[model samples]
Target chain A: MVVSLKDIAARAGVSLSTVSNVVNGYRPVGEETRVRVQSAIDELGYAPNLSARHLRLGRTGIIALAIPELDNPYFAELAGAAIREATSQGYTLVMEDTAGSYEHELSMIDNSRRQIVDGLIFSPVAVSREDVLARPPATPMVLIGEGVYDVPHDHIAIDNIAASHVAVQHLVSLDRYRIAFIGAQAGDHRQSAHLRLRGYREALAGAGLPWDPALAAPTTAFGRADGLMAMRDLLARTQPPDAVFAYNDLVAIGAMRAVAEAGLRIPEDVAVIGIDDIEEGRFSNPTLTTISPDKEHIGRLAVQSLVARIEGKPVEPPYDVQPPFRLVTRESTLGGQRPVRT
Target chain B: MVVSLKDIAARAGVSLSTVSNVVNGYRPVGEETRVRVQSAIDELGYAPNLSARHLRLGRTGIIALAIPELDNPYFAELAGAAIREATSQGYTLVMEDTAGSYEHELSMIDNSRRQIVDGLIFSPVAVSREDVLARPPATPMVLIGEGVYDVPHDHIAIDNIAASHVAVQHLVSLDRYRIAFIGAQAGDHRQSAHLRLRGYREALAGAGLPWDPALAAPTTAFGRADGLMAMRDLLARTQPPDAVFAYNDLVAIGAMRAVAEAGLRIPEDVAVIGIDDIEEGRFSNPTLTTISPDKEHIGRLAVQSLVARIEGKPVEPPYDVQPPFRLVTRESTLGGQRPVRT
Candidate 1:
């Protein structure tokens, strides 16, 4: 049965307005009366009608975090942080997986789903800046990752190009001349891939090495299988690279596997590095060398920014936030060392 | 600006009812009228208010998949399948990460969040059968995993004891006299852990080996760190086991790392086997041997069952569904073979 304020007041032997005050906290009630009303609510199994209440209040106490890939550990780790933060801030964070599809990403920004959520934290990979710009401004949005930029939204991401420069410079310091870059996309699909590829080229030039289009291998996706196939193709070349840089840790680990399969030793033969310090990279065969972005900062700040906009709190202008990142050197680049077990 | 049916009708130069018919499909409109209304909708960016519509229908086209760990790749893979299935079934699946906390798991079943979601597909780990039984039946819930049982819900899980038998037998068939089991919980919190432990003891008896409590290591949690610490402790014993059977793939991978750190060769010195063939195991240094559960079946079936119940379809009375599992041998158990690239 649908219990109403009258039913609760009747059971608690209080007035209907007193029960309403207790439920909505519009006014403070005496301790004894509050306890009686709470007991009555528990016995009646009263769940406040959130849909009606949200419609009246013009706020749903729920937000959405739209990500490109749910299976990627980097995104998963970042999402975990976001979920915790959203819960602590008194909101439910629902994840919308775009799977890096253009239509799905567009739907996330402009669809009927926007009516149910108070705000959105989006990590767009398939949608371009123009697509994001055309979205209606009814629902507040905070952008994360390097997919779309220069929009009127709170943007949070790491400096992808600088991170790539650090990764390539690490390999150069190890005296590796011929270096290959894996996970270059054909079109302007993944913005980070383009930025990382550009950084790879600039770093090579900075180190007085010629940029070879053959060495910049392209893959359809940034996954382990893609890395394995791309590394195999690179290895088939006449003068294979002695060092490899992959888009992310999953690809780097796959490339490392391909290197081992060809009976080649890491560092001594093909040193490898990647971005995203995922947990798998830590316990990998010859633990991976990677650029560790501050995932906690990116995840938490994105939620905070969106919540600020949702609540209409004083906020700065649409700021392009860049979280810090660092290069981690592991056994993949420096062999003959004991693997770190953390 | 809120674009309503009146606004669309005014823009399309049609009656309000005609625009309503075009939007809701309550009645078929003429082709020309439908095209005119759709173009007006596109121009005005009219999003049908789903919140108000769902409130009237008393159904929210949203389902939730609550899992214990979001960071675990096994759960992530399962969630990916569940999300796809939920999308195919015309429902938005929102993930609730309980993080294996008792309070969070309880909240998922008995809180206001239940009122927002149409149904729940929960993989509970911390809540008990009694806790689940006490939940309100207002919202439909489908339980996955072996944490809770004998509740009035459609339940799905792999045969944990049977899967464990296969894992232990795989180690015994390799002529490994001494075998260890990692990730045994202290109490009845994780039901699968107890079942797997019982299976380990039964398989040992079948092999005519004496049961050794020392070989069965208890962990605080079933994670990579837990397995690493437990395996390290086991290796410090007077006589370490020759093989290890882990709770899942993450623990098994950590145990392998510990063995490698101790200068012990895989399979020759210590063979390791894990359940849940996560992608990480496929690309580990020595590809791991695992009992692969049908995660796709479990993920999809749980969503389908919950969606059916939410839509008030006739369902079989609270089925205890058991999916299939298989043993996959890799270099971790059988040495002297090239690693499978795929």
Candidate 2:
């Protein structure tokens, strides 16, 4: 049987509004009456009709976090934090994998899922800034990651250029020259790639080293295989680089595998660094050196910003947000040491 | 403005029922009429009202895949496959992380999410067969993984005992007499642990090797850290085992880290094997030897089974399913060799 507020009210010998107050906490109810209504609800096995509530309030209490890839541990770790925060804030978080497709990314911003989700936290890889600006302004959206920029949305991301600069600077501090950059995009496919490449160039110039275009390897994707293949091509060059700066931890791991396959010692033959200090980095054979972004901060703040807008809570204007990040040195850059828990 | 079926019918110069049939494919429509209605829909920018449709049909075109951990790449890879299958099947697949909590697992089976999801594909870790049996018969659920058993539902998983036996037999073939088993549960938690332990004992007896209780390490969790700590404990023993069989690839990776930290060479000092041939295993420092379960097969079948039940398709009765698995040898159990793509 569908037990309604009326049924509980009748059982508790109180008005329907009293039961509503107890169930929704819309208003203060007397402790005695709340206890009485609660008992009636429990005895009757009452469950709130979510569909009816959705129709009446125009809120589905569901939010979506749309990301580019699910296999990447960086995104998976970030999504885990967002899910925890959303659950704590009384919302159900659903992950939507866009698979880095233009069509899927466009559909996420185009009200295709508006009816089911109250808001969206998107990490776009394929869509342009103009596409985001041209989208219908029906659903509230909070952009995460350095994909689309300068749109009127609450944006959360780490400073990609600064983080990249730090990673390259770390390699320079070790007195390594001819550093190769892996996972450089060909065009305006991934915005972060452009920013990271600029940082790599700037860091080299700052260290009194000439920019060599041959040292900048372009990868079609940012994965282990991409890193391995790119490193192989770099190693095939007449003068192989002494150090490498990869797009992320996964790519760095792949490069390390390639170096091992070629029977070369790390730090002596080639030092490697990456971004996103994922857990995998901590346990890697020679632990990875990386630029660590505050994922918990980014994930929590993205959901909080979107939820605040969804509920019409007064807040700051839509602006770019850069969470803090830091450089971590490990065995990949330094010599081998005993593993320590992070 | 909300563009309704009436608007499309009016614009296309067709009857409302005809438009409905064209939109829903309830009956065959001529190619010419379908083109006319499609153009009308495109011009009007019509999107189906999912909420209204939900109320009318008492079905939500969304399903959920709930697992214990998102940080674990096994689930992430599986989720990626399920998402692809679900998208191809014309349904939205949302992920729910139970975090291996009893309350969350119980709620997933007890219609708490029935209003939002049409069906569920669950990989339970905490709930028992009795708990599943006692759930209300409302939402269609398909079980994945070897957590619970003997319930009347479409179950898909690898044969844990048989797979475990193969893992240990591989170590036996290498002439390792003292083989240790990591990730043994203490009590009733994690049913697979018991089944795997049984297989381990059976394999040892078949090889005429004495079973040593001290070598069976029990980890609180099945993560890298857990494996690392368990391996440390075993390494401190007066006579450490010559081989280790971990619960999964993650644990095996952690154990490998411990072996490396203790200044021991893989395979020569301690041979290791794990289940779940995740991508990480393929790229680890010394690549992992593992029991390779067909993750794509299990993930795809889980969604297919749940979707078939949700659509009320006529099929065979609910029964247990065991996807194929095989032993894969790599650098961890053998001497190092050039990396090969799988």
Candidate 3:
């Protein structure tokens, strides 16, 4: 006879959700409760029939992963990591490459005529207050990368502001004035980018350096091309800054390319740094010195968080998981060490 | 007044499968039959109710994408492309990161008891024939990348042998003999890697050069670290090879690093090339000279084929998609030029 979650719950003397939570390992059950559930499961030889459960729940066991695009390796890596985590947890992920579009993102959530998934792990290109509040999914949802400030759901993200500040501070500590900012966004509310930019400003202010608007160039997108464009624009300026902090590695790579095109050497003539510490960053012409997000950890955490929420567990206040970002000072930012902060 | 596949099928006087085939745009119906289907769909305003149809068919509207690892950009890009295409066809994708284990791949399929979605797009790292046929999924399956041969599923992959042949031929054309083959897998049926290796040998055979086993260093895994180790091993041999052909871009990057560590210059000292012209390949130290699979096209086609199979259409036999791979020779193989191939 096929043992069921119901039978397990009955034997364990717990709520059905509790049985589900135990089976899913989404939430931490009390030791005694867990032992009872395990004993009941072992006694009944109960197997979680996903197909049957899927039928009753009307769940497709599919989740939508709305990422920006594949052109950038960061999104590619994030998507890959998420897929790995999701599959392990018994969820299938379908991808929506919006190329960072508000309309496409909104359409993805709004146009329900075509989707059959139970939840969404949306990483929007940019977040709007209206967009965040307007359409929260009726199904289980999780937010990654971008934060939906007012909207509450399971969110997994890196502290963009803190990450940027860390990056800028690293550069400043190296005593490299004439620091430039690349890859700023106009009216950006994704918070990460704006916050990172803000961190750059704060670091400069803390260092008593004048905030130079000419030094900050906002690109149209977050990628190699955008980085190159921003760097090229910076290079063409009357006074190109010495050390440049790019939005991410792709932008940093682009800036390096533009720097090469301009016949200036990296770190020597113009020290360059970036974020997202993509694998390529380590092998670029002048290996990039940048801030890196722990992609593997993030992926694992996102899945664990979603699974928890699915089981109705109380998680940490929906704050970003500031997985320690590392500054690998490579050829691009090789300089004499600066004094440390107390 | 929701439009359904049945409404169109009834109006067209065709089987529901035929109607589904038409809607998914997989099989080619006769001109007269096409017209009838179109007219029926138009008259009924039969917009596919992606959700309810998914419910009735028990389609989670999710497809599982199993790849080795996203740590490598090639798989990451492939996942992104697959997800994007799947999204366009109104399907969400569930990703499974196998990390290159046949057991893991098999377990994912076996445990697919969830009936989450209608199909799977699997890029198996290591699945034996017996194992594959032993517990095949009731749902349609499409194989991508690794372990294509003998798998009873619709397989989508680049012509690895031909692509490798092209890489070697390009190296030969440059008259760089004493070529070292880096990142050759020891024992594997991943036709792409094996074929590419064969192609390298074939090019040598075609050019009347000896296939030097000493120069062929096989690596345990296809990654940067492995590539470096393989290259280092090759460099330590009796006589260093003049040029190197890596299994993939990550391998190439690793080999490039090893060459640099050994104080050799790219192309000038030891020309290096790779396959899967990953994004980083273009921006690497010497800019990798490699073969580029139309990954975007591959991803789109995989989804299209899987969707067709799930919708019960007669898909073409599982054959290698020898989509035109280009020889993108950059700074690594300095003198080589890119042949304009799609």
Per-residue lDDT for B228-251 in model 2, tens only? Answer: 999988998999989999989999
What digit string (tens of lDDT, one per residue) describes model 1 on residues B90-194? 777888788999977887887455435788888999998899988865588899999999999999999998998899999989999899999988888899999
lDDT of 2 by residue, A1-342 (tens): 889789999999999999876664344567688779878887887865333333235576789999998889999889888988987876778887889999778878877566468899999999999999898667799999989889999999888888888998899999999899998888988999999999999989989988999999999889888899989889989999999999999999999998988888887899999999998888988989999999999899988998899888998899789999999899999976857582
TM-score of each candidate structure, all chains considered together: 0.88, 0.88, 0.79
Model 2 lDDT, residue B326, Cα: 92
Candidate 1, residues A1-342: lDDT per residue as tens digits?
998879999999999999877675444577788889878887887766343334334466789988888888999899988988988887778787889888778878874564467888999998889998888666899999999989999999899889989999999999999999999888987899999999999999999999999999999888887888899889888999999999999999889888878888887999999999998888777888899999998889999999998888999899999999999898999987674555
The alpha-carbon deviation from the true structure for residue B146 of candidate 3, after best TM-score superposition, in angstroms, is 4.1
In model 3 chain A, the worst 10-residue window by lDDT is A333-342
Model 3: per-residue lDDT, tens digit, A62-108?
66777766557776677767777877777765565676767667756
User: What is the per-residue lDDT of model 3 for residues B51-161, given as tens digits with 9 covering 90 to 100?
Assistant: 435533546576777777756777767777887888788786766567676656776666443344568888876777677787644777777775745767777777777
Ranking by TM-score: 2, 1, 3
Question: Model 2: residues >4 Å from true position, as ranges?
Answer: A1-56, B1-58
Ranking by DockQ: 1, 2, 3
CAPRI level of candidate 2: acceptable
C-alpha displacement of A111 in model 2, angstroms?
1.7
Interface C-alpha RMSD after superposing true interface residues, each candidate, one decimal = 6.8, 7.4, 10.1
| All DockQ scores | 0.41, 0.39, 0.23
What are the Cα lDDT values of the candidates?
A: 0.85, 0.86, 0.73
